[model samples]
Target: MDEHSTAAESINPKHQALIDRLSTRRSATTTSSDTARPVADFLSSFASSKLSIEQSLSESRSRADLDHISSLDLDQSSFDSASSSLLPRKKFSFRNKPQKKEEDPKNVAEISVEPSAIDKISSLSVRDGPGFRNEKDTTLVKDFRQCDVGQGEFTLSDLENCRVYLKGTVRALFFYRIRNCQVFTGPVLGSVLIEDVSDSLFVLASHQIRIHHAKATDFFLRVRSRPIIEDSNRVRFAPYRLTYEGIEDELKESGLGEETGNWANVDDFKWLRAVQSPNWSLIPEEEWLEIADISQCK
Candidate 1:
């Protein structure tokens, strides 16, 4: 019994000495002094970043438990395939920059025949701009007087038997396939393009005007230059009669504030004679509409 007791006491003292040595090593490795503060801060920040990264990864996707893992068993192709969907995407903001579709050059009126466009018209897939489109028997009014209207273009297409009121100056304007419509607008800073219009009345002010394939239409224009026409007949022109609140300011800013009298100078590509073109004629003053009061339109 004494021999066993002595052996146990000796074994305990050796174990105790080894424990003291390990505790001394641990204490020496700990950092607390002011001189070691930078090291402590660096370690703390590194730990915080690592924790945040781990939390983000865990929230996004589940990971396999690695606690019992003793060897790597990753499949390279599977890893790539799984991670590909987690990649970042390109940045976009539609408010600042609108998405613009590619404009087909063949869609230009001068280059293409109208009869061959039935198949292409279905594929045109009208892109939404600042104006109305694809309407039948509807009344549409766009009051852009409160917008930065000069920065963007307006489009009106495929409309039939409609009344359109466009208020405020714009960068440019486009009209296509309009029929039996009464259209009025403020000044256009750039040019105006019209195509395939019939039996309509237009009151507009613009820097330039071009008409194509129009029939039995009437125009009241405050223009900077002579208007041109192609494949159009029985069209009549009159002085601009549009008026609205703040329209003078809008027109002044677009450089069309005053009457230019160029509306009477009509140029028809189909009529190249020295005599006046029979296609378009100036409307008599008696038939002119009274000053259009569109202020109360909205």
Candidate 2:
């Protein structure tokens, strides 16, 4: 019994010495001072030291009980995996610059022109008779079938809740700030431009159609080129469905007699992606209206 006690005393001192050496090594390896170290880092260090001490105690127990130690084996890989998962994540940062605000559309239009420019616009000649402008809650009709060949451009501006009809060929068509209106026109030999229109319906044939800042509008068009739009949303496209007396001759003269089927090939300048643009879509056939016959409007 004395010999056994002596052996236990010697083993206890050796184990305590080993624990002291491990503690000293851990302190020496630590780079950050206690004042500068984050709380999370300090906690991680404490956990690592606690795990080492537990491992040392288990090893000492194994030396004392060989049969029990043989039945228990430590998994180093699993321990490392658990430790990695428990570690705190690093911080992230964003460095984007602030963007400038866009100008108001109403204010931009009010200051878009100088006094001299306004005068110049007023002085411009309309040899093909005056085009409709600033009309509201009224029906305006122009029968171009009776007019001469050199029909100039037509303008529809600031019209609200109005119905406009034009028969026969025209050089160009321009529409601005027209709301809740129905505009049915004959073939246009040149391009058509529409801006700031909302809740409107348009049926026309043109070489090209360009729309900007329009919302909730539907276009029934026969266009020779791909129709384009910018800053427009909730707009739908369908084939032209207008019929009138001598309309075939007018369409032939304007090079729009054949249905090119380009009306649904819309190009949204704001959307450039492989998927279809959300701003425009083909009108479902069930929702399409009957062919508009304006021959009786006169």
Candidate 3:
């Protein structure tokens, strides 16, 4: 009984020391500081006891136990292979910037066509001519009473009035000053002057006209019996013939106008517009690159 008690005391001390050594080794090797120390200590004690059992075992028993343990270790390795699928994924690598693609030159050109367009039928009259009162200051109804009105020589006013019809083209786009006439300030009438046949945008009678190279049409100007009121109290109407003389001076002078904005150089193709509006409303998708014929309509 004494021998057995002493042997147990000695085994207890050795077991405790083995537990302490394994616990220290596990702590040094593993990063899992959050794991329970009691659980690790229990596992270490279990491992030591199993090793002691194997060392003290009979040769036959040891062989059998070792075979069994080897089979269990193989089974554990197989389980690890299965459970490996549950492991955390590695970080992924991705490209930061995308590559630029090459564009076909023809496609680029078609996409960049100008939006504004010029209208045809450049000339139209706001009012029929040949009124007796050519100028307000030059004529007086009271003065006509004492003078011979029938003996007057032929004048430009008379010739202007005698024309039964006038035909011309729009040379430019302009705005008429509404205050001067009963008509409101609006789209310029007689925009392109048909003095002869000229293709250009110019200013006329102090009005600015921007000439834009455009596919043309021959839609006649439809004048309203009543005046049109637009954003301003201006009458909006189309006209025939836009005169270019004033626009030439403006282009040569400051080389700028309301239509061109900051684009002053005449030679710059980027400065070119068929008309002054910023919208591409009239252009068809297919005909963006092609010019419209000025002489006829499609």
Among these predicted structures, which one has the highest lDDT?
Answer: 2
Error of 2 at 133 (Å): 1.0
Model 3: per-residue Cα lDDT at residue 64: 61
Q: Please, what are the lDDT tens digits per residue for candidate 2 over residues 76-173? A: 45434543454333546556757678899888887876456336444544324457877899999987766663367778887899999998888988
Best by TM-score: 1
Which pairs clash in the backbone of model 1? none
Worst 10 residues of 2 by lDDT: 66-75
TM-score of each: 0.58, 0.57, 0.21
Worst 10 residues of 1 by lDDT: 65-74
Query: What lDDT tens digits, residue by residue, belong to model 3 across residues 1-298?
Result: 4533444454456555645754665555455544444446556556775566435432224446545443433233453453233222244766675668789888888768634322122232223322232332221111111234221211112111111111122223222111111111112232322211121121122133232222121111212121112111111113322222233343233222233221121121232456632311222334322221222110
**Candidate order, lDDT descending:** 2, 1, 3
What tens digits encode model 1's per-residue C-alpha lDDT throughout 1-298? 4533443354445434533643453345444454244334544553464455444433432223221111122234542343233222234667668668877777876556665544443345444676788898988888776775555898999899999998877888899889999999988989999888899999999999999889999999999999999889899999999898899988898899888899999889889789988898999999998989888876
Cα-based lDDT at residue 134, candidate 1? 82
For candidate 2, the TM-score is 0.57
- Provide the lDDT at 88 for model 1: 26
* 2 against 3, candidate with superior lDDT: 2
Backbone clashes for every candidate come to 0, 0, 22
Give Cα-based local distance difference scores for all models.
0.75, 0.77, 0.29
